[model samples]
Target: MRILVTGASGWIGSASVTELIAAGHQVVGLVRSDAGAAKVAALGAEFLHGSLEDLPALHAAAREVDGVVHLGYVHDFSRMDDAARIDRAAIETFGDALAGRGGPLLIASGTLGLARGRVGSELDQPDPAVHPRVANAAHALALAQRGVRSIVVRFAPTVHGAGGDHGFVAMLAHIARQRGVSGYLGDGANRWPAVHRLDCAALVRLAIERAAPGAVLHAVAEEGVATRDIAHAIGDALGLQTVAVAPEHAAEHFGWLAAFYGADAPASSAVTRESLGWTPRQPTLLADIAAGHYPGD
Candidate 1:
């Protein structure tokens, strides 16, 4: 299959490109900058120069590929509404190109807030009213009805690995270093799901190859790791104390990351494993953190 991967220079996208190429598929990576193109080329993928805002470029790339792994998202949390708008437009553009084509379109989404106070599963439907990105996931799933094999792969909040992981876990580590103490929110009982980056990349490859239309898959390896435990791990690594911040002060302490650190969005990948014959054979979250890979040695 010839796959077009948007955000191909990104953490997960780059990994996915490597996985696909190793599986004997041709990959065209969508990149926005010269450095991004060089990164994609270094990964042995043909580079398609464009950003998510370029609808014509996106449509052209979508139309030219056998499948698309849409992983591009504007990560500016300060302007989430604008980011969501761009995501919606990009997905819609791809959907229009792939509509009635029976081509697979695997989109990256999140499992956060899919279930409240319980382990989320593939069966949970994303509430469109909650987050605009969740709504975008719903819209992508609807494309399946129009003959597009659209699958939404909801990633765990923390996708950690050895190299270049700037996700939530890295943020926590950075914050800990800055504050001199590793902190968690409100007794630190909230749970966060996580996966290794390579494991996540393998799952994306599987979804592109075998996932059914409209399928929602979880790329979680560890269902939930407690916030306190995560804080402790960071503290241990940095030789600092682990402490808990009151819920009221969570936002003030953690800033934009407070909501994520305080969330209890545990998720399971049992169905994803069984359905796609996929298994995550990587170090667990705590193990990865303790392995000294996160703090950059």
Candidate 2:
């Protein structure tokens, strides 16, 4: 099968390209820049030079491929609505093109802000009308109605690995470096879900191949890694103390990341594993930290 992958140069998307290629699938990776195109080509994928705004190009790309794995987003937190708008438009453009085709359309969603103080699961429905991102996922899932086999793969907050990660784990390390201490909210009892990046990529591949239309998949390796333990790991890496800070001061100390790191989004991937026979074989957060990935410069 030939797959058209958006954000093909991104962290998860690039990994997915490698996975798909190894599985003997041809990939046409959407790249907005020459460097991105070169990177995708280096991964043995054909490059489609276009951005999300180029609906006609996106449509053409989708029309030519057997499936799509959309992993791109603007990612500017301050302008979240802008990112949401772009996602919605891209989904609409691609889904419209793939309508009545019965091809797979795998999209990236997340477990954050779904619910608080509870473990989010594949059985749990994100309020389709609630968050803008949630609404976008709902829209993509609805494509199944039009004969497009759309699926949403909700990833955990922390998708960690050795390098090139700008996600939660990297943010925590950067915050610890700036603040001189590794801190968590209150007693740091809240939990955050995690997965290894390669494990996540494998799940995306599995979903593309086997997930039923409109399936909502969770890519959570360990259900929940305690925030306090994460703080300790960061502290151990930076040779600093792990301390508990008041929730109110989390913003001041941890900056923008404090808002997310302070959240308790313990997500479960039981359904995903049981349904797909997927198992993650990567080091856990604590073990990865202990492996010296966060050593000082």
Candidate 3:
């Protein structure tokens, strides 16, 4: 199958391209920069220059592919509504183009905010009121009714690996180095699910290939890693002390990333594993940290 991938230049998206190509599928990666284009090209994928907000580009690209794996997202927390509007438009464009077609449309969603104090699963639903962009997943799933095989893959907040990782774990290392200590909020009891990027890419390939219509898959490997444990890992890596930041002082300590670090979004991938036969082979998040993957500066 020939696949069209948005955000093909991104971390997981790039890994997905490699995975799909290795699986004997032709990939057309949608990218916005020469660097992105080169990354996809190096993976032997054809490149189309466009951004997610470009509806016409999305329509044209979707019309030519057997499936789509949408990984592009504008993660501007301050201007979330604007970012959501762009994502909604892009999903709608694909939905329109793929309507009446039986091809798969796999989209990336998050396990964050889906649940608190407990583990989130594929069975849980995200409220659109909390984050407008989350509605894009629902919209994509609805496309299944129009003869499109739409699958939503809700990923853990921390998708960790070595080298080019810029996700939460990397940021925590940077914060630890900058602040001279690794801090966790309120005894650091909260938890966050995590997966290695390669494992996540494999899941993407399986999801686009065999997922049922309107299926919601969890791309998690470790169900939960306590914030305190993560803090200690970072401390060990940077040779810094691990400290517990009081809830009231979390904002000051973590800056804008405080809320995310404090969130308890543990998630399970049992359904995904059983449904797709995806067993993660990559190293765990803490192991990656120990390997000195996320170096501050």
Candidate 1 lDDT, tens digit per residue, 105-217? Answer: 99999888889878899999867999888899999999999999999999999999987899898998988888888999988888999999999999999999999999999
Best by lDDT: 1
Cα lDDT computed for each candidate against the true fold: 0.92, 0.88, 0.91
TM-score of each: 0.97, 0.97, 0.98
Q: Estimate the overall C-alpha local distance difference test score of candidate 2.
A: 0.88
Question: lDDT tens string, model 2, 56-153?
Answer: 88888899888899998888888989889989999998898889989999999999877766888898887877789999999999999999999999
Candidate 3 local lDDT, 164-187, one digit each (tens)? 999888888899999999889997
- Runs in model 3 lying further than 4 Å from the true structure: none
RMSD of each: 1.3, 1.3, 1.0
Once superposed on the true structure, which residue ranges of model 2 sit more than 4 Å away at CA? 295-297
Give the local distance difference test score of model 3. Answer: 0.91
Question: How many residue pairs clash in model 2?
Answer: 0
